[model samples]
Target chain A: MAVASSDTAIRTSRITRAFIYLFLLLFALFYLLPFGIMLVNSLKPLSEITGGNMIALPREWTIEPWLSAWSTAQIGVQPTGLRPYFINSLMMAIPAVILSTVVGALNGYVLTKWRFRGDTIIFGMLLFSCFIPFQIVLIPMARILGILQIAGTTPGLIMVHFVYGIGFTTLYFRNYYAAFPTELVRAAQIDGAGFFQIFWRIMLPSSGPIIAVSFIWQFTNIWNDFLFGASFASGDAAPMTVALNNLVNSSTGVREYNVHFAGAIMAAAPTLLVYIVAGRYFVRGLMAGSVKG
Target chain B: MGFLDIDNVTKSYGAVEVLHRVDISVEEGEFLVLVGPSGCGKSTLLNMIAGLEGITSGEIKIKDRVMNGVHPSKRNIAMVFQSYALYPNMTVGQNITFGLEMHGTPKEERDKAMKEVAQLLQIEPLLTRKPGQLSGGQRQRVAMGRALVRNPDVFLFDEPLSNLDAKLRVDMRTEIKKLHQRLGTTIVYVTHDQIEAMTLSTRIAVMYDGYVQQLGTPKEIYDSPANLFVATFMGSPAMNVLPAKLVERNGALHAVLTGAEGQEIALRIENAPAAYQSYKDADVFLGIRPEAITDPEGADRNARNIQGFTNGVTVTEPAGADTFVTMTLSGKDCIARMRADADVHPGQPFEFAVNMDKAVLFDPKTEERIG
Candidate 1:
């Protein structure tokens, strides 16, 4: 009798587990549904997309929309493409990511190992920058860019992103470095290593995970940023996000929904690639950075 | 001039002082151990000596050179941290050779030094492995190897063995002592464990509350502690402090202690120093080691100050070789190390002998030793 009841209990637990998995599967599908529709519609011709079966696989599959989005799409008065804007975004993000991450790393090293008076207060203020609304800085930033005479250029956008991105990068690096043993720095000092030597040989080598995290975070933010891209860049200097916005919102011609979807995917592709390649490290870095030693 | 001199060092932050004006000097090739409980500023003093911390208001001289404002690398000292502090990203060989590389030593010379130190530490087989792959003892050896490769003017150890288990700590302590003996390099070690200080150091500085209470040889610190704090802090099962009245009896001084049943047991203060004369007829603390009070047969029979008495034992703890017998003296608990073979039981009277020549007395008011 005990065995029979235990068997029933096991069956009940299996049924509960199955139900839970089924619910989770449906929840996951709920999130993936929009992307699925975008993917399906992205493959179809304008005629089929207009027929409005958005979730169905394309009956007449074509790569013309992708080609058009890449090279021949009309954004603003220019008929060039998102290709230049994509390259522009890369140019802006790569240097910004590298500069901000390096600065943040140095700041983290000094804040943790070579601490001065009121260091925590300084860190707190730097962290506060991460929370300020971007709208509040837009006007002053525009004026600063105009004053610097680099307005509507890629370098101007790069500068804007670097200045704003430092707070988050510093936050990541500082919290990650806080758990690092200060004794290693002291040991290196006693070993005759100077400040930069210790940073280069001792710190940076051990900063792989946090570096990935910082780079990904900065790259994603700078790449997907429409506000700063639209505000600080124009014409040839416009980033992919701003170009995508122009393409989607343009009122000059008939709406090409497939082209819009393909352009959106292209704009989202780099960050998605980064996440897919290093998603595990991203999570690990976030966890390790937040936990104190 | 001494090899290393810490003259009137005072460390303060804002209005609070963590280390008072402290002074210590050690000759070359001397092994000095600074010992105290936690929050006693031993680590802070070590940091000052290493030039890792500012001296606030004092001069630290190494080999007749004032090290004030000097960087740690320029100070020519190597320290083995309590955490080992091995760079997790580097192999043991890289960790050992890093100092040389930073100093711009040639590749061949760096490899030679690394090999020599690694062999000395018996970590040669493990040199290629990272710190994460090594055991605790191996990691400790790697840390030492890192220091040893530098051949610095002085060596500083900050409780390097405190992280090890009991058996490993003992083994490493002996290894450190052997290494020091072989190298004869001047070393300044810091530990809270008095036993480690006693076993490994040529001189021990007993500190308490930012002050160096006593600085002497291990035997001197053990046999003649400076005050109540040093006396109580430097012994295993610590020195038992019994409240007693110093009474003058027939031109001699006697410490009058009451037994558990209110009976008086007068222990004669034989060879009492002249300083005790002023403390007569006043309450004092009679400090005695557990081994000083033992079973009659287990004591030094020919000692001039041996005194035997009967006391009621409240507890008996047999620890293999010697059984610890607890008794009451002047309304306080006192432990006596007795022979394991001695037939003694709790709740019964036992005969015990105290070697009074080794006993010490402290003034009740100042807690300072009274001769």
Candidate 2:
């Protein structure tokens, strides 16, 4: 009788497990379906893309659209490729990521360890900046970049991104350092390490996971930003996102769906590559930063 | 002048005072343990000594040098925190030599110091491992090694063994005592466990409510606690305090206790301290250790004023080596420590002996020891 009861229980558990797997499969398909369409369409010619069958795999795949998007694609009056803007995005993002992360780490160290009067209020103000929409800062940022004589240049875009990105990077590191034990800092101080020495030797070494998180987050935000890129840069200094937008909305040409899709995919590649490479650390940083010891 | 002096030190956070006018002096090579229950300001006092916390008032001198505003590193002290606080990223060897490295000690000298500390702590095999890979006891040893490698003027341990399990805590406590004996470095250790304070300290400072209740040798604190707080806080199974009337009977002082059954028992006081004479005919709390009230067979027969009385046993708790027998005295439950073999049954009359000479008298109103 016990064996019969156990058999029934096993059967019920098996059915429940099968249902769980089926639900997860559908959930995965819901997210992967759009990327599948983009991939299949980007491989096809414009005629097949404009055809009614959007979900079907392409009959004949070709790399011509990707080639055209990289080299001969028209963005504004220039017949130059997204190659130049891609380099422009890299120049802006690399320096922005490095500077913002360093500043954020220093801010985190000071706010958490060397806190003085009204430090929390200052942190709160900095944290409040992270939630402000870009639209709110668009006009002021443009004037500030113009006054600094860096407008219409990549440096101006880099500075704008750095200023806007500081809030998020600071928030990441502040929360991470808050969870970090204060005793380690105290011990380092008692070991005769000064402020910068402790930061360089002790705090920075332990910041591996958070560094990946902040870099990835800031890189993705600056790389994909279109509003800041469009308002602050022009012509030769335009970022890939701005160039991609111009490519899709060019008024003179017949609509080229495949080239636009290819351009979109190319613009997203760096962020996707970042996530693929350091994705594990991103999740670990989130978990470790949120949970206090 | 002592080796380390904390003169009238007080600590206040805003309007709230945590440690009030505390005074402590440590002679060189003395193992002083600051022990109290939680929130007793023992750790605060230790932190002040280490220069980790700022003193609100008074002066702290180390080696006759005023250290009021000295940095912790410049004060030449090393601390072992309760959490061990080992750098998770560094190996045990790096953790030990970090202080020396910061001071720009030569690599060979740093390596020598690290090797000596590792050998002294028996942590040589664990030197290459990160703190994350170590067990609690191993982490504790590495923390001690970090402090030992510095060879500072004083070693401060802030409840370093409190994180370990019971068996490991006892074992580490012995290891620490042996380490102190061999090194003979002036040490200030803080712990909430009185047993650790009693067994490891040359002198124990029993603190309560931000005040030093008593500071003396372990035997002195155990035998002659300053007040009800020290009397009760220092002992496990706590001293039993019973209200009694100090009556003058035929030119002799007697503590008259009325049991729950309305029966009165008078125990004579012998060689009472001079302070007890003024409390005649007044109510006082008779403080006696559980060991002083034992089974008649195991009682100290040679004690100066041994008195035996019959009372109804309320409960019997046999704790392996000794049985804790509870009975009623002055309408309050009083626990007596007896030999495990003593046949004690609840609700039955039992004969328990009391050593009156070892007993203490406290004024009921103030709870301060009178004799």
Candidate 3:
């Protein structure tokens, strides 16, 4: 009986592992197909792309369109081939991520740990702001920005992102911090840790997942934004999203589909690379926040 | 001067006053334990002494110096938290030495202190491991080591064993008592466990509703409680209290114990308070420890005498070493701890002798000791 059971267990283990590998292989192809199509289309010449179906790879791969997308096309002709716009997007997003996450952590720390009055009202207000539609407030916000004379500048975009980013970041941190034992904070105080000392030494060190979550959220929100970029950006400060929109929607002549696809790929590359590199952190961050909170 | 003095300390959160005019003093190298139930401000008062909370309107002095505005570090005190708040990131060695490092001790001296405490706590092998990697007992010992390495003037422990399992709690309690005896440091520990307080404290401060109800040696708190709350709160199975009236019978005093169906058993009051003699039938409360009222054969002849009384058994619980018998006396429920050999049974009437010598009398109105 023992020999028969051992034989059955070994067979089951082999079959289970095979099934797992097949499942993962299938799942990978499901996501990679669209990215493959985008790459093949971008590398193809306009004549071949216009003549064939969407998913087909080009018979002859050429670097002309890549160069055109980088230099000669209307999308690329502005300010060192849309490089300044790429810089603008990064400049706006990094600081916004930093500021929002810092404010969020402090807000969260106070909301959960500090027993002061009116803290509930403040937390409620932050939660409520996350539900307010950006469409309803865009026009009034633009007008206000115009009056403040920061309507179309890079700093203005950063400030807007910072303000809008606080709601989600604060929620993330507040919920994350609620799981922390209050006894630890009291112990730190009794151990001679002051306010900032407690935050830096104890609270901040344990904040890896929340920081990753906040960073990813803020980066995606700021980098992928088109409506805000169109409304707020002009001239050299226009982000890559605005440039991508203008490239695809231009009505004066027949569209250069190859350059357009290349530009699209270029515009989407930074976020794609970020998602790939920090993908583990992204999933772990969300999972940690869900259960830990 | 006492090493630590708390004079008229009080605490209130907004409209709620939790502690009211609490006073406690501990001499140098004394181990004081504050024990109480939940919602008692024992933890709050300990926090106040550690300078984590503000006193409502009183003073706390350590070593003849006012500690009102001094920061916890400047006050030169160390505390072991209830949760054993080891720094999650630091290893056990670092957790024990972090305070010393903060106080700017030399590296060699810091390592020496850590080694000494680790050996003392029997945690030398766990020094390189983080708090998350250690067991509950290991973390507790590490917390103690952290507090000890500081060599503070006063060590504060806030329910440090409440997080452990029962077996580990008992083991740690014994270790803590032995540590106190060996080091003889001035320590103020807070716990809700009566056994822990009884076994570890040089003096136990019984707290209730934020005030120190009584402060004395364990024996004093056990034998002569200041009030009904302290009397009942300090003991296991608690003290048995029954209501009766003080009556005068023939030139001697007696307590009239009324039972069901108009059965009145009169018992002698040998050392009756002078105030009781004035009122012939004044209502009073008789407080007796569970061991006081027992079978006549099991009664200790040399125990302190209260007014002599007799009670009828209504239930019997034999606990091997001793039997807990519950009875109806003076129209209220009373419990007594008797010997296992005392043949007690429920539903059968038996009169148990009461040792009135150790009994305490309390005024019904104020719940304060009458004599």
Candidate 4:
């Protein structure tokens, strides 16, 4: 770690740098073994996976399992694919991520810049949402969802995730903005920019890194949620994670292990894509707020 | 009413008042400087004038209009912050025109105003660049340009040059003074450096402990400070304040004190103020600047009462342009400023000249000026 931190140190010691890279490569291969196994089996035929080595390369490699998992797979006595549930997850996650981020940014701006009495206490109470056990709130959340009359719907899951996501998003934003200079806000006020104008023009423009952090965080949490999807949502309204479970556990004919691996990978694909695309900004955002916003 | 009136304004957070009954009225185009050490309420007073902070009581008026509850932007005033506060995401052109844009000015007019200010401040080439790309001096010019393009009724500066290096600070100080002269705009600048206050302001209000100790012209504040705080706070190496006896000698008033040689010396008062007669034989403090106590050759030749005395020099520091010699007077370390070429050294009994015309007396108990 120390050898990689400085250019001079790395240049002066080739043996140490080589050794560090070798160690890191070994660890990388070790960590990727499970993912490699899953991908390798997902491409093999069902007979090869049931009777042969799980880690062995297939003699007849085909994408039949991935296609079957997408369209014709049996999930809870239906031949309908996991595609609809994928759309459900996307719908729930995208709106939840966006709305929670906007709300969190506004909360952070008011908490740090436009401070009023007992603001810290209000923020403390809001933080309770982050720490409260997800299981503990299951009943109350279900009650609220029932009262809203949108139970078992995509919007219902969005509301659940959006409300639950605010605490973490707000936490990220407030700390980032706390390091921001208040003099800039005062200068804007003197320059005749109103509250919303300053938020949109001044605060939001400068909040790129934190917004990326919030979006990535909320999207991953909301998209991969199985407990909430299983407990509250049902049938066609179920998210990809719930539908993937039914595909694997349904006591139907053939018990296809290849299709189960494919369905599991499909359920995990969106989060992997999100992380791969936004991974660089996620690290930068966390580091920026951790060191100095 | 003057062009700007800060009449009986006092600011308090809750029960503790930070500014106490402050009253200063600035005339049209007068540069009023509020100077003090940090936390002495100089910045607070400037904020109140800019309407960034509310005035606790007593109304502030600009052009005879009450501005107690007016918004900062509605007050028609602009402020240059110590940090410059330029928007980092905007180009210099946009930063300069942001206020005009917010005020609903047309694009053509905003562009024209920004171009005029950029050219005036000699930053036309930097207009396309963001503030993050500009140097410290260029950033300062942009901040000032933002304030100037508004053509405000008043310009408030809260230690704007303090963020610069010493050389840049001096250069910017001169530029700000030149801009003030060319525009003749009423400006209330705040700084802890007394040199800036003296050089830049038409009138200065020296504050300490939430009180404006004195408000006068630079000459008045320096030559005749209202009290001990003003006298000591306004000069470099601060004014020498030592104990003395206001005794009558030879039918005239004299401030008698111990010289460096452990012998009594009497410096006569040439034209004593009328109240000095009443403090006969009473303990008082004598105030004198380092320049006032000089080598006999470097003494003010035109001073009516240049009383000469011999004192032992303990330390001689030959600073360029002038040499400072420290000696013991009235059992306190008194420094005297002498010529750079003055032949003086430690352990030498040097003959010093005291100009009585520049000397002021302060009452011992009250610390207020007696003469």
Off by over 4 Å in 1: A1-13
Q: A-chain TM-score per prediction?
A: 0.93, 0.91, 0.87, 0.93
Runs in model 4 lying further than 4 Å from the true structure: A1-20
* DockQ, all candidates in order: 0.87, 0.69, 0.53, 0.80
Sort by DockQ, best first: 1, 4, 2, 3
Clashing pairs in 4: none
TM-score values for chain B across all models? 0.99, 0.98, 0.94, 0.99
Model 2 TM-score on a 0 to 1 scale: 0.95
Worst 10 residues of 1 chain A by lDDT: A1-10
Question: Could you give the CAPRI-style class of model 1?
Answer: high
Residue range B1-371, candidate 2, lDDT tens digits: 99999899999999999999988899999999999999999999998988889999999999999999999889999999989888888999999999999999999999999998888889999989999999999999999999999888999999999899999999999999999999899999999999999999999999999999989999999988889999999888999999999988887899999875879989899887788889988999999999999887898968988988889999999999999999889988899999989989999999889998779888878888895
| Backbone clash numbers for all candidates listed | 0, 0, 6, 0
Q: TM-score, B chain, candidate 2?
A: 0.98
i-RMS of candidate 3: 1.6
- Candidates 1 and 3 compared: the better one by DockQ is 1
Per residue, candidate 1 scores C-alpha lDDT tens digits across B205-288 of: 998999999999999999988899999999888999999999999888999999989999999988899999988898999999
Better of 1 and 3 by TM-score: 1
TM-score of 3: 0.88
For residue A65, model 1's alpha carbon misses the true position, in angstroms, by: 1.0
When sorted by TM-score, best at the front, the candidate numbers are 4, 1, 2, 3
lDDT of each: 0.92, 0.91, 0.84, 0.92
DockQ of 3: 0.53
